[model samples]
Target chain A: MPQIFRRSANSYARLSLLGALLLAGGLIGLIMAIGSSSYVTRANEFIEQPIQFSHLHHVGDDGIDCRYCHTSVESSPFAGIPPTKTCMNCHSQIWATAPFLEPVRSSFRDDRPLRWIRVHDLPDFVYFNHSIHVKKGMGCETCHGRIDEMPLVLQQNSLQMQWCLECHRAPEQFVRPRSEVFTMGYRPAVPQSVLGPQLVKEYGIQSLTSCSTCHR
Target chain B: MRPNQNSQFRNSQLPRGLGRWSFGRWECAAILLCVLAAGCRQDMHDAPRYDPLEASPFFRDGRSARSLVTNTVARGGLREDDHLYQGKVDGQLTDTFPMPVTAELLARGRERFNVFCAPCHGRTGQGNGMVVQRGFRAPPSYHEQRLRNAPAGYFFDVMTNGFGAMSDYAAQVPVADRWAISAYIRALQLSQRATVDDVPVDRRPELDQAPEVRLPPGRPETPPAPEAR
Candidate 1:
């Protein structure tokens, strides 16, 4: 009778252990698969690009247009990646030298999008609309830093919430006309007393610049 | 599960009573394990049956509570201030547009009423909503004499600003919706009044129709015959 009871106890203990192990393994797998997308590559730091395309030689030295590569900087929220066709517009005839040509060739052959490393990533809470900033005469370099000058683009300023708040704190200081949005060195055209008072009265813009405007 | 009782059960063992018909050590261990397994229960009523606003941080304060100062939120409780814009923010209560008593508006008002008002004021506007059923004080009926005589503006003010235990619905209900609800309240008041002669233009929205109001028992609107003088 004692032997029967001990066998029952040991069997139940083994079953419980197996159940706990399965539960723990399932939980760990769920966390990992959810945390990292299997189909997409994610990187926190600089990723090796398909081509070591020199923004230094093209945009910096030659003073080429940024829109020449980035097709939708002005219109779209995403300053979209230049399609392989776009890269081929120049590189098709002149693929002479750009070491990382293998990744670009692979992208064209496999129909895979070039996974450009994001230098700047904003937190989920802060909603910084690119359209408004782009329309309000702020240039790409204002927030993104000297992207036109960097060879391998890296984040210049800490894109912290406080950093964005500092500008929103006083829009009168940085904001300019929509035409001058891409003008890197441009400042607000008019003084606060000269234009701010007039615009405030005309637009009937109430002070909605509260915490809920951004937080909620 | 707490181990205190299980430890006590284990300690209660006294050599299995040292005689016949006594339980063995394994039986004692089994009983102790069984005691530990039966001690975990959570309350189901934690979800609270009442309206969430009644339990909001602002109204539950025993003493005067200063709500966080924001442009949107009017500071003191509605009646606390001089019955105006609460004076903290730069706005007027009457700056809102007048709500037209259309059928569409009434339907919307009723939907809003159920979502918001039905918690405190019943679906029939009898002040016997679920909260009242759960032992809360019922809000006054819309057909009350004082409220019936009250202007649409007054109802809008009360709804937006709140009165007594009620908190401001300004945040919960929009300005246009507040006026629409006021118009609906007036309709309810008119329904209970029973006579068309006493109904104002704003209250007599459904005068051409029956099935509205339905007229209590025997009180029907009878026009007096014209006498030759």
Candidate 2:
């Protein structure tokens, strides 16, 4: 009991309590940061595909429309991946003998599908319909980013629940005219502030945030 | 050790009085937080269901989407309307359209054509499209007398079954859209050959002011009018 604790121990004890609280908060914050970061979310990451198809070449230079290959985007829940025949539609003649396109050719000749990697895969619980979004004036570029500039396509946005809620909460901030839904690099002729609300009203877009809106 | 077994062993080793003890509020809270953190596994993120085009381990082809068996027609897929599905009447290509041609249909056709056909056929059906410029075989110009004289069903048949170097677009273009594109092709044939006399009396004056420069096919100068929708 003879001076077992120094007088300075009081301040040390106080500092240790504060440090413990700070360490807990820092741990929680770090977990949250990791949860939303590109490492977990896979945003802005280019996935390797069966073929190194260039969106920049097809969309930007050749000016092929998105609907050309994603034929079911306007009518189905899933935007259809183009069958190998779609690739051979041009590659059969344009790059007929190019060794790089042998996979595309073999897939066509053998009638087997090319195992193209999916980029924007959402969690199994989420149900996204391309047609409804397209109908409601959601541009492909809005979520996919500048796909025409992507040599190899990448997931343009964090396909996280909170990220989806950003648009679902205020669709007016993002919607364009339905006609411009497929147009890449779309710029609002009127300022978005003026045009977004009008288009939202016109398209009858609801800010559906209920769990069932996506979960079901 | 398994968590339950470890806890059971610890409980057996505890003194009799301490064995009946409960955790403090902080200990309980910490345990609850640990349990909650542990619940963040990817079980829900990757539930046992195939997403569209997901690979399947069971199928030899590794496709979750199975191909339709030969001659297996889906419900409501009989497609008995030869005029619509095959572009035929009495086994001959018919010139008449199954649906009435409207301004709306033309607009839809123009949009779909640009998306599905304009790469090879060109925006004006001139056959010198971007793909042709890129060294794909140049298709016959729609303005050609041969194509102009061809029946509407002939164009639809060509799109449905394909001809010469071109492949069939039946998989990509729906039946209704093929007809619409056929109508639009007829319109293009007319456009290239039309003289001043073809312009309506009321619109003739507007034509004289300035020949409006056509933008690229997909980029319409104006959003479709409300009535168009």
Candidate 3:
């Protein structure tokens, strides 16, 4: 036969096989890169809310307690969003006419709620209760990172199943005294290893690994 | 062969680029099947049900919350204890707690008070809370004569039914919690007015260590003679 082909068919076949292997490897790396991207985890992303309320100003500088805003944390499954009346309790006097606080003012005047966008939204399947965790001596800072330091709130933790299971498996590592549950800058008075076990017993927490604890 | 016969022979054969350019019929069918399969399976996310508090257009009221017919209470919803639920006996506010006040109850009271009352009432119940500083109507200090002598039920009554500018905490605070907060408020009142004699003899020595009294900033300190140190 005349030399119609560029090279032997065998050589072409080997080159194609190498290209196929390289392509498969590249595809897998791309998938992993996407899986670990910020879009998936939402880490360090500033979530916009109706008000530009700075935690740095309220919680850090002014020394207002977290409970002042998140009122139902210790009593209910949901951490209650403060009604406009709560904001007006202060803003009706201080910052009464600041343009930035107009939304808050309007909401108070109209009796309509300022619909704040939720930052740490868990999926419906996960049954997380703020009260139970708070009562059992978990600090607000444990799941929500240094919130007082943030200008605009962001979801700091991944809040994935694997992340949840880490704490659930070893709750002693995270548990504090009930008195210190609301203390944002809480540290163990004794070392955590020595104190954690005693707290777990004191709080009557059963470190549950059951799927139904969260899934149901 | 004639030129027309040659052209006919080439046309009848398969196109030369078929092997390199196109997928087989089976491969195209498989891709189409996969695309259709992906489109069909979204049942979990789009399940047929109303979310909690979702508005219903079918109802005339446009509310998902259906009111109880006339007066229907759910199981375990019957609140029969007058002392526990109403904080009263016959018609007057009772002076006693329905349940025994334990250390645990006091702790719960402290937590609940900090969250609900401390914004307006101050953590120490001094009526100098953040809201008061920012100029809401300042509530009277719990340490004042009027509140200090008020019965425990009086505090509960105020919380249960709002007094003056304050709104009722009945919705925010459960009945048992109202009692607990009342107990805590009493403790706070006593804390401010407590005398040195009120301290236990064994603990009295600890209080004898005079706390360092630093003068306010910008005031000149009058130094005692060098020997007074």
Candidate 4:
């Protein structure tokens, strides 16, 4: 009777071990399906913009002032998108016939504002004041990642807080002023004439490595 | 040095345990997420406090503060000729008069005008004042048809309530002083339109003398074409 009981106990132990192995294997397969080797589709996968404004055009051709398009940058916290009226002031005579410009023309006719979809998004906790940056000489290009070259206005940088603070901590390594900020390659402009050092002198921006600075 | 058999098993066990952790990655992650979820506790009842005294003048009515100063200066002014809209309250603590526009009060008015109005409206009451030199577009000339034709009471309204871009002087300039400024502005309009017949015979001589700008004439090298361009 004892020998028979031991044989039965051993069989039961084997079945339990096999059950455990199967559960573990199933869990591993689930993890691999959801988490293992995560992939990111390239920014090229998406294309949904109203006007399809070529950043390459204005920033390259007309030499229009950045402030002319983004007038509120020096005054408001936002680097404000220009109003429809602002576009109509010039486009009423220039590109009055373009199909993409219909939305802009409609807004002007309706006396309504344009609801532009923001291409880049940042967490709300980050308090970024464009006025101080613009006033102190931070350029459009330093953080925007060669925007003048993009056809459909894809976000060049991740714009994650860490990415911002990395430059904010060591601005001399990354930041450049108006003309230089928009450049595609490493801008070898003079140091004091550039934005990174001038902002330090003008406003004395403290180290951004601290969480309190951006988080607040 | 070669380890004993028991010690070798122990060493192998250590490696195997570490391997087990990596092999069972979902278990490790699930435990980590559970721990993180347990740690997150928030209390959301704390509210920030603010003091009313620290509120800006725009929020707190600043007119009351200016009225305090106005009451003290209101005693000596043109006691008549001002049809001020006073329902019952007479410039915060005084009841004797709403605004006194006496000759003595007009002198104070002239003094206050030079202090405030002359910067925007010239000493001669033309809108081409010193502020216009500082790149501010001058207001239309006070003697212009529109402003000249405007009522005396309407001029007082502008000083008290302020026209566009100009901040209301109701807080800075006293109400009686505002009346004084209106009287002086009217005096200017009358001066421009006053004829010899309009002026009393005794005061006609001075009123007839046309004012002239004294400029150092540059004797131009060749000066025959005298038709004013």
Clashes of 3: 0
Native interface contacts retained, candidate 1? 0.00
* DockQ per candidate: 0.01, 0.53, 0.21, 0.03
Predictions ranked by DockQ, top down?
2, 3, 4, 1
Q: What share of the true interface contacts does candidate 4 keep?
A: 0.00
Best by TM-score: 2
Model 4 error, position B171 (Å): 29
The full ranking of all candidates by lDDT, starting with the best, is 2, 3, 4, 1
**Can you write out model 4's per-residue Cα lDDT over A93-211, one digit (the tens) per residue?**
45668787999999889755565556654545556788766655466766665565666676666565546877777765554443343234334433433645665665555556777
What is candidate 1's lDDT per residue for B49-125, written digit by digit as tens?
32211233334342122346565545554453422333222344332335346998887677567655766677778
Tens-digit lDDT track of model 4 for B1-229: 3347656766677866664455478988999999768645322211232121122245334211122454454555544533563212333322233355577766766755765677657777887665555445567777889877776667667766666656456545556667677777767777788766887889777855897654222223344354444
* Model 4: CA > 4 A from native: A1-47, A177-186, A191-203, B1-229
User: What does candidate 3's lDDT look like per residue over A1-216, in tens digits?
Assistant: 345357688798999999999999998999777655667778779988888889977787666778766777877778877778777656766788899999999888875567677778676667789999998989888999888899999988888777898889999999987767766666565567889899889989888889999878
Question: What are the lDDT scores of the predictions, listed in order?
Answer: 0.56, 0.90, 0.79, 0.59
- Write model 2 residue lDDT over A1-216, tens digit each, in one string: 255579999999999999999999999999899988999888888899989999999999999999999999999999999999998889889989999999999998998889888888888888999999999999999999999999999997888888899999999889998888888877676667889899888888999999999999
Q: Which stretches of candidate 2 lie over 4 Å from their true place?
A: A1-4, B1-40, B211-229
Q: What TM-score does candidate 3 get on C-alpha atoms?
A: 0.73
lDDT of 3 at B69: 95
Candidate 3: true interface contacts recovered: 0.17
**Higher-ranked by DockQ: 1 or 3:** 3
- The deviation in Å at residue A36 for candidate 2 is 1.0
